[model samples]
Target: MSDNLLSRFLRYVRIDTQSDETSKTFPSTPGQLVLLEMLKQELTELGAADVQMTRPGYVMASISANTRKARVPTVAFLAHVDTAPDCSGKNVKPIVHRKYDGRVVKFPDKPGLTLDPATSPELRTAIGKDIVTASGTTLLGSDDKSGVAVIMTLVERLLRETKRKHGLIRVCFTPDEEIGRGVDKLDLRMLGADVAYTLDGGPPGEICWETFSGDAAEVIVDGITTHTMEAKAKGMVNAAYLAGKLLAALPRERCAPETTDGRDGFIHPIHVEGRTERSVVKFLLRDFELNGLADKGKILRGLCRGLQASEPRARVRCKLRKQYRNMAYWLRKDMRPVELAREAFVAAGLKPYDHVIRGGTDGSRLTELGLPTPNLFCGEHNAHGPLEWVAVQDMESAVSACAQLAELWERKS
Candidate 1:
């Protein structure tokens, strides 16, 4: 199982499936389609029934039930195929340390970069286990490729072992999770699962059902432009200068990603662009509570109003929109999905623990859409960066947990 998992992860990471937020296309990038198509072929070859890749780059398949249970619920396992656009995923050369001895690890491409186990306590736990990472020049693509491999391996295992009693299982590989548009065009009706789980979490035995409610905001500042020779404070209003002032006015010392942790929320300005005539500033507002998320939006709106009033000559406008919500809001009502995951982890010889993500996942939206989706760990760490890594043993454990989860669902029915 370790060998197969490692090979699948290595193959998936080598294909550059980084999503592009700037693109208007469905999958955001063509490379994502490449991987999605590949997954469709693999699932079909693995004897998975109803294997299909949607027009929007969603690969959906199913493993028929081998159990005699009459009322087993259809369970769906999900994972994203696209890597984050924040880091370079092109030509990702995954390096597998066959036997990880607790020591300071260095990268071949970057002489100055080093990963010390002492600093990263999670790496210490995998002292004698196999570790995988990328060269210093690129990200390891472990953010979700690890999840993809785990699901695929589970499918393979279930198919090979016909004697393992389990109900029907659905597999879905989504694209563009990094930019938070993973399920924008998802065919939920076609997916047809009573419950779902996303294999997109960190560490081993981690189950996340809570996530930050998310909103996206864009501030467009339109100003007058004139030649420097004729430029005057009263005659010309520089949008770029106003944009900088608005950014500076933000509560960076307190209400920002760099300063916030735990359940604390933040108003993060991610992108700023344009020139003296016009500027666009995009921000992401996040909080675990809906009221807190609304408060962050209110803060940004008040700031925008202030900027408009201060510079009457320039037109300032802010567009705030919903992205995803915390899954806890819905999961708390019926925690069967989360409870099943916990029992499955214990069955796999792992002590399960509850966790909350400072960020949101595809499961967040799926839960909101009435799927009751929870998140499961695939051993990814330091995601969306060049220092990303995963343990082979941990991935195998995740596969075991997934298999146990299927059996538990069948047994409960």
Candidate 2:
């Protein structure tokens, strides 16, 4: 059977596997287990060894070494099964643009939403190529689904094609990556890979190892509320007003998601819940520098302190938590894994380049768990939103890269 990359990607995204951030469960969503189960079954049908879906809804499989090398390192590839909750993943309608003509494409479902070439110059690369996107009502889910399809397609080819020589290859699909809980319950000891690569990056040539040091904070305000018509300032502290004051105290022009770009960190309020009696504001802080992340947290604490001081009657408290760190701190030690990826790109007749993930990946947490995992490009563009798209050719390139990557490792050993 010919590899239908787009068909696989579109099929997976249709399942509405959006993860929940507020859930206390390990995977945080039952829908993700359905996708994970499907992957596990498919891997078994593909004759992959040790295919199993663990309790936490993780699907792991292995392809035995076909090469004669005695010391080939075990290389694994990973992708997340869950989609981001920032947009609606339910009832997603995907649109496929055949032979893109280097122009902006408008969506029929959404009146004003269009894939503009100016804002996303990456679309220019898809000129004269096939592109897959969503219909502006929902996200395309290419951020990691494209990665899932690329790895699954590659695994099928490797297991079927007898002449393809490679080392022991492992693959895993994780859950809740968007909520920063992807690897929290992942059993790295069971994965048992010397080094790994996450097929979860945008563009074809990008090889990401450096990601932002991340942390999160939540501020809660408690107010003494009474009837608004009967109260002047008598023991009535509005939580909504205090929440607004805390948000307003932050410097938006200096360190906000909208105002910052490459190498500059930003602090953004991701979600907020408000009422007259209580309010909650959650923020995500990111920076390439450790000191910068710490400073953002410090500034947030100071703002909360001032807000509390000003609104003496209201109770305000801020709790900060650590998320993930830059993977470069671990990858730079040996650098061989990155070197092997570059060699694979060269072998696959493509140019390899370095990239930085402004956000974290399963790789970030996996690397922190003592496995050197770097991110590989899998054709995701305009991720986590309505304008998301993927070039079919970039996915083909990723498949070629994955196949040749294992071969490169076997040759070196």
Candidate 3:
């Protein structure tokens, strides 16, 4: 299928692949497997060898080495198939804007919501490019779907042009990345790749190798309940009030998402559920360094202890669990991967910007598993929200970069 990135991306996003965090299943959602199965069948039709899909919604396919060189290293390209659980991925309606002029863009479905260049500065970067977005009611799923199109397009080009020499290329599409369980059950050793790059970043010409070290914390508060007739006379504690008190007592100066940016970490309360007798507040803690994350965890624990001291009759517990670590700092033993990606971007006729991402990707977990996978740009902007968009030109540039990366490695010998 020689479909354009726009067509391919639209086709992929038409399906609802939102992952579930509460599900105990490996993939967390059956919809993810539908997309993964589609990719598996399409890869097989594309003549990719050793195509296989795992029960957890990981699809792996390989393109054999075309070069005669025996020393070529196996490289992989990856993206996720699932969309974020934060937004509705059901019945997404993507709108295309051709030859964008610098103006205030409005979503057709929403009369009041506007995407201004001043508020979303990233829109400024796509002034002259063809942009794609969803209606105001839903996210476009371009976060990684555009990434899927980029890799798929590159595969078609490499297969058609027999003269293009390259080493073995492995393509992987994972699920539940938005929920942070994309690679939880991945079989890295079986997949067999020396190095990899995830097409899962924002803007064009970006090479991200560093990501935040992350942990999820849950605060469980238990309270006493009394009859309404004797509420004041009998001992009664409101757990929801206790949870809110602890949330308000959290350090907002240096530990809040709004107060931090560009490598500084934050403790963000993403979800809260409570009753009069019980309440649970979930937080995501992030830091570039492990010690910083540990400090945040300590602060949370200290808050719980203080709450206990103030309310001896109530039971409050704070538990911080590891999600993923900073991949670049923990596993990258060489600079060649970073340099090669830069070279790839330059070959695609664009300057590359390498930065420490404020968030995590599937590459973060894969790198932690010893593959040293870095992230490549796919033009995703304002991801996981109704304001998400992707530039067509930027996606084409990413596809060119992927192809150039293969050619560069072949020429490296």
- lDDT tens readout by residue for model 2, 221-258: 99988988866856678898899988888899999989
lDDT of 3 by residue, 1-413 (tens): 32366788888998899989889987888888888888898889889989998765689999899999998889999999999989999999998888888688899888899888999998988888889889899989998899998998888888888788889999999988998998888899867888899999988888998999999999999998888688778888889989999999999898899999987898899889998799999999999999999999998989999998889989999988889889878556786878888998998898999877998998888888788899999888999999899888888888889889988888896
TM-score of 1: 0.99
The C-alpha lDDT values of all candidates are 0.94, 0.90, 0.88
Scored against the true structure, residue 208 in model 1 reaches a CA lDDT of 99
lDDT of 1 by residue, 194-294 (tens): 99999999888899999999999999999999988888944888999999999999999889999989999999999999799999999999999999999
Q: For each candidate, what TM-score against the reference? A: 0.99, 0.97, 0.97
Query: For all the candidates, what are their Cα RMSDs to the real structure?
Result: 0.9, 1.3, 1.4
Which has the higher lDDT value, candidate number 1 or candidate number 3?
1
Model 2 clashing residue pairs (backbone): none
Report residue 135 deviation for candidate 2 (angstroms). Answer: 1.5
Give the clashing residue pairs of candidate 1, or none. Answer: none
Looking at candidate 1, the ten consecutive residues that score lowest on lDDT are 227-236
- Model 1 bad stretches (over 4 Å): none
Residue 36 alpha-carbon offset, candidate 2, angstroms: 1.0
